[model samples]
Target: MTYTHILTRPVRFFGFAALAALLAAIIFAGAAFGTTVFAAPIERTDVLIGFKNIPGFAEHTLVRAHGGAVTKSFHLVPAVAASLPSAAIRALERNPLVSVVEIDGEFTAIGHSVELDNTWGVAHVGAGSVHHDSVVGTGIKVAIIDTGIDYTHSDLGANYAGGHDFVNGDNDPMDDNGHGTHVAGTAAALLNGAGVVGAAPEARLYGLKVLNASGSGSFSDVIAALQWAVDNGVSVTNNSYGSSRDPGTLVQAAFDNSAAAGVLHIAAAGNEGNCPGNRNTVGYPARYASVVAVAATDKNDKRPCFSSTGPDVELSAPGVSITSTYLGGSYATGSGTSMASPHVAGVAALVMAAGEQSASAVRQILRDTAKPLGDSNHYGHGLIQAVAAVAAVGDSSPPPDDSEPEPEPEPAPEEPTDEPDTTTAVVSDISYSTSGGRTNDRHLTVAITISNGDGAPIGGATVSIDLHRNGSRIASGTGTTNSSGVVSFTLKNAQTGCYSTTVTDVVAEGAQWDGFTPSNEFCK
Candidate 1:
């Protein structure tokens, strides 16, 4: 059976009527940011290999990897130049430590790389965290795989190192359907004075156009882009589009291969709702193994009518009336889960920034802290909260000595004997790793611990792992703590170097939430 768990909570405004009536007074309190409504698969190529024994690994062989547990092993060999796969496998079989081996690959969330320029949306998540201290995801490279992004926009120009259009097989990834541009802005718009801010202001953006100008393309183009990203050094790959059909054996294989190389693959849940005519309809890539599918929700924490629903949706974010950078140095507001996917991708970047978190850690933080929407079908978790995401990263990290003193403990209020006041919950003491490395069929293990403010162990708390390097995600996993409040997961067959890992605390809604954020503590 597949493992299932809840990762986020829905954002619920308690008093809509009262709030609306007082809107005039609160007009300047906070502007109503535009909202948009929108909205993974797991696999065995999904299994991380052990480090004890790897086949076909030779010294000096350049190999890419995803989540591996052991970094150093006796049987492990560095990437070396050699065409003798048969000889290498035979030689490895002769060794007692050699058990199994696979080629290294990357699976990253494709995103748009460009200059950071934005307002309402940019700093929403990455700013200020105890873990990362600085905003997470700054100056990271995120690859956008869709129609394309306008590479020359003033906001995106300076940050644009280079990108290619897989659709036309050229360097220009200009957006024709406007979908890619919109998605790009949401992920990494330059934080200049022009439009809005991106989830990662300091992130470097790369545009990989898999979709055509009409907002659609063949699966082959996407596969090609995936290969290109792997061949190049892209860390994250964000896909904001989807279809209801299977991506075919070849395409799925391509995705699997890429993930093995250590790139994160993020996708959008299709916009189709539960219509009577639909039959098992869900978004592609979203339904596929290892993908982080996203959904859409409004400010009220309700699903928009246009947003799709299903098991494929991994999380929810601001999908309605979202303001982002548009083509030609302009800004626009729009809706769709297509708009929501990038926000999560940006959060993934932030998670990577905070610590050496595996893909699973980033995904776990998103789900556990996600505000649960009343309409669970449409809003998978709830509206994605940037502050909360950043906070999750912060909570999992320890504060620097130079930082301000910890906040004084608040006095516990007297409890009413009648009907335990169930509205409060306590969350405290969070920590994680800032891991960034490549794998090569070697096992890499990360140790984690969790506890409550009273120093009691917090059992059953969930943690996420996101393995990323060069601005991409390789693999992800989620695990829960045992009675001891400690758990360990192995990253099998990794490439090596500069990988990140993160952990999070998921408290029930009825208790007070307290903890240090694990935003940024590791990333080299």
Candidate 2:
């Protein structure tokens, strides 16, 4: 028996001459150019216009003059989203101020409808163990950028902070489609005893409604949602939506800028995998370097045939028959990379709540601690290990000293015969440098030099450094001094702020530390 395949094609423009005539007739009607004349009707298309420089009043006026209506204006990127006659696209492309004019690409909530069941993803990713350590993503803000969320759901109501709706252009981002609510529940459902709990149960949820009731939306709306998320202090964003085709440079820039602003974007790796061979089928914006692309796995920790695979797949999570919150305060199960993406996003929130604030730091920890699940294309780092990732963060901080100090003993008499005097190590100097071209890539590297009392380099010394930003300790690391008596500490993805580094401790065999305040501070 033969099967019929019905594939959906992207919207295309046609009849350019007729469209031009229609626009001309509308513009020149009742004007000096010509008298009013009827022409063939033309369809308006939504587009994203990228400018060479910061767009302002002149740019807005230019779009208006071309019979275009500006819908969204962005400050992070020099662009404006508008609806205009298809004929005006050529005119805008020819303008010196307009660098790019592309149709706003469409994306959909990527999830396969399935029957409801018990959720095993949380335990599979070790989120349960993380919760035992009190890292339930408390105080971490996660933006669910998809269909709006059911904020009234008992499983998500309390943690639902607030959000914006790009679909209806309203403040209430109530989930019209069940996909966003499901994604939000996977990332952060409440810890109420009656129902299911999320990976980061305590994480604050912000529903940024980009997709509509049909689980479809345009790239321009997604960009607007991203900007809103960044401006509203969202630390992590769960994007379970994307298209197989590229969304263009404008959308890429929006995601990049949002990531640079300290938001960790976790997205689905599109459910378009070909199991017979290794293929590059990952979707954007997940394909972008700035976002973490997650693949879907089954309960047996095996990659599903539908889960897209490529080098961009950063992590894999339980996506098959994963049960989560649905619309109308109900619970449902779904499958796809969509279910997998939120597992990573929730793990990210757990990492942040465990004291890892930097988006890059959280990403590195997730990658470094993931379980090795065979191929990189199938599992990037592997299944995300929330317990291990959060433990890594805990490892960086000093353990609490709760035991009472022992009473000081009387000093013993100095020994008449001594083997040799203990060598004293001192922090001679501290310096720092900034590197990387992009904001998110930029980091702060601090070099600390250790020396002896005679000003000689002291190698083989273990130096502990604490990095602080805005007066709070952000990171701490210990390294052995090399032959040059220097050890460097780097803070990845450093934001614009004041930073300082201090040598907290130094240890060497048969060596003592010289009593001195060794620290340096700088602003970047």
Point to the candidate with the largest TM-score: 2
Candidate 2 residue lDDT tens string, 1-524: 11111111122355999768755644653253222222233577889999998666577668766767566667667898877789899999999999999888799988686886788999889999877766688868898999999998999998888887787665678898899999999999987786778999988788889999999998988988887777667789999998989989999999999999999999999999988528999999899999999999999999989999889999889999999998898899999999999999999998887777899999999999999998999889999998888888758566322121112321111211112333656678888777776543486777878887667777777665557789976665556677778876655567778887655456555455532334468898
lDDT scores in order: 0.54, 0.79
- State, as a TM-score between 0 and 1, how close model 1 is to the true structure: 0.51
Each candidate structure's count of clashing pairs: 169, 1
Per-residue lDDT value at 219 in model 1: 57
Q: How far is candidate 1 from the true structure (C-alpha RMSD, Å)?
A: 26.5
Query: Model 2 shows how many backbone clashes?
Result: 1
Best by lDDT: 2
Which sections of candidate 2 miss by over 4 Å?
1-41, 394-396, 399-524
Mind giving the per-residue lDDT tens digits that candidate 1 earns over 258-359? 777767887777667653313334477777776777776666656666666765566777676777767777767777677778888887776666552466
Looking at candidate 1, what is the lDDT of residue 200?
64
